[model samples]
Target: MIKNSYIPIPVKVDKIRFETEDKLIKTFDLVFMDKEEEKAFRYYPGQFAELSILGKGESPIGIASSPTESGFLRFTVMKVGVVTTALHNFDEGAIMGVRGPLGNWYPIEEMKGKNVVIVGGGFAFTTLRSLLIYMLDKKNRKNYGEITCIYGARTPGLLCYRDELKEWEKRKDMSLYQCIDWKFGAEGPIEEAAVEGWEPINLKEPSKTKIKKDIKKFTAFVPQLVSAVKPGAKDSYAIVCGPPIMIKFTIPVLTELGFPPERIINSLENRMKCGIGKCGRCNIGPKYVCKDGPVFSLKELEKLPKEY
Candidate 1:
């Protein structure tokens, strides 16, 4: 009974939580303004929606909250463009437009019963957070193998979902390795100082928090954490999302650890005008990122042209 794919439904920003210290990245909690529409909006964990602010523009943003957390949807936006800036400026209770659950999701069926390795950095961590949460839910955890996550940011302050990450760290069901590229006065990640074994990764000045052991003091590149963890690739799928440099290095390591191309998944993004397949900007070879992807297993990706 839902109508057109291009028509956006009006929603109200339920709340806004700044995920980072600089406030560049924010998590907006959203709910449909219409109760009927809200009850009907259903999206998978790795899917995305076209978020619009009318004159500003409509942009494709991934759904950050898992379906397991059902009452509302969440989108984490980094202020990088006119549309995103508009989203960040909106106050709680502000009305906005959304059109989606568009784009293919992470192959949850393929991931079932398999170990999962989630790797991400910067703002690209959004969808990965969704996938992780869905997999870790009590009803779903038994359906999967061991879950490991390697997440990083440039500095201590830039990591997303720290509160959830902290709670995830406390759970015995999953393993979380959090690191940073560097802190103050470092040329590069401290792990660069040694070719083998993990360095202390300590901060120059200790954290003021009196928890006896603080999470922020840890320092290393995202790849370095992957190297140290060296997750078993025999029955595992590695889902990686990050900037070009990080993805370039991380893939080789995952391969070296024994994961085949088929078992590695990559989330791709391209310039999107219309979230539906109508507009050609999101096209890559024969596929449209907004429709066919945003999530692709490496085997599926290898068959496509390299232009993307």
Candidate 2:
């Protein structure tokens, strides 16, 4: 673990895997240069880190690999700006910096014995993947009740961790519901309702209407897919991570299904930067997204300013 929040620990890129077909998003696996740092680096799911590149700046990304998976840490990054683009250009074995294991984590202890409903969309599924893998481990599996996941992307190619998603689908221990915004056929992309800008007339009920038939893939927006699956809210906690629009729409569906405000949790990764409270970039009212949380119960968030 890092003793000083400002000093970044040295690490080397062990592996890189492209997640999206656009060649923009990639997952980097890193290992600490010092064996002691590796031993000291203790973290739980939902915490984030600042990946630093000398002379290029740093980017805050959530820790995608769970603690159960040892030896390395994983971060899925989209090459959007200067720092990310530079990191993407570097080859394997390149050295970098990781400044954290910072911020609060998902309520792992609180979630024990309760059913878990994970709802994620687009690239925001990184930390959720960590939480899921942590819970699915043999030692942790019996500690939680039923596990259900609802994940969707704009298209099949946009989804991250495709191979693990496939393996997740095959597991009898949990239920996975995957969807894509539109299904492509010889004609082209089908289903306008699944598109990002399209809003349903009724937020609680997603429109099932489609522009075309004979599309093979499950086609629906993340919120719409949540409504269709309709996981029971009794004795359960709902964790949501996605674009702001998706989270805005999903909360109502989960609430309509009987999840109380406190039972609904959200991860505000977009609000984070610097991975520490010093920057003040991640503050909403008196609380800091970097320090107070990247994870918060819906009830907790409601108590804060509406800035988020």
Candidate 3:
């Protein structure tokens, strides 16, 4: 609903919490500075905001929390660049600048009655988390068929939202699968035995309690992950987010599993300046990655040049 490009609304930080042990990922719970701003602002799943750290400059980050919870907004930021690193240093109750919750959202209506398959790798899972929660909201839950989530990271400790993932796994309406490319050897037998039902046969649990971080070795097992999330021959959709290489291989696997091009959704990563359509940095051919999408159907993706 935030349609204008120039409006700069001041939002006070309600909380800045670390959701992951890795210093890279943090969640900021924010509310509008003037209570009225909250009344006017709303966004759909997969839309994004332009967050400015005052003098440090602005960056576009996805609205990582679902729109179902209305009082506050959240952004799950990974500390990758200068502005983000500075953002990591901020504490609770700080003020930051926020602009449009811009761009077209995922086609939730179109997805009704269709099984949802979500595949996320590394930090890319942040935006996918928003879509997952949106679908899980009470009214929306029944609109879709079975929900399947396939999430992976470089290592066990590197995985974000461990507690949330555990809870999601318990839901009767959803099937959740998580994998770490390498083991850190921290959990040992207990953790190993627990995940056997979800992992592939060739990648069995190790006898030792400690594990190593080896993402390269895990690349071979990606096909198996794809298999676990593949829907039946009909009535399903797949949404994927992750590093470029993971996405590159996963799409082919989904196509082989018979998911049509129009049913496959993906969020692209590119250098974005404006959260709205104004910035040119994130353009892939004629499309603006920020406004036209962070989310795109496979049919639309096929039309774009492979510059992203």
Better of 1 and 3 by lDDT: 1
Measure candidate 2: CA RMSD.
4.5
Model 1 per-residue lDDT at 68? 92
Name model 2 segments beyond 4 Å from true.
1-3, 185-189, 192-217, 270-273
Q: Of models 1 and 2, which has the larger TM-score? A: 2
Q: Tell me the deviation in Å of residue 32 in model 3.
A: 1.4
* Number of the predicted model whose lDDT against the real structure is largest: 2
Better of 2 and 3 by lDDT: 2
lDDT (C-alpha, whole model) for all candidates? 0.82, 0.85, 0.76
Give lDDT tens digits, candidate 2, residues 159-194.
899999889978888888777765443245444444
> Which candidate number would show the highest TM-score if scored against the true structure?
2
The residue pairs that clash in candidate 2, if any, are 1-40, 1-41
Q: Estimate, for each residue in 1-308, the C-alpha lDDT of model 1 and write its tens digit.
A: 67788788998899999999888999999988888897778788678999989888898889999999977889999999999998999999999999987888887888899999999988899999999999988899998999988888877678898898779889888888776766455565554342222234323312221212323224566765676667899789999998878888888879888999999999989989788898888887899998889888888888999877
Give the runs in model 1 whose Cα sits over 4 Å from its true position: 185-218
Q: lDDT score, residue 153, model 1? A: 83
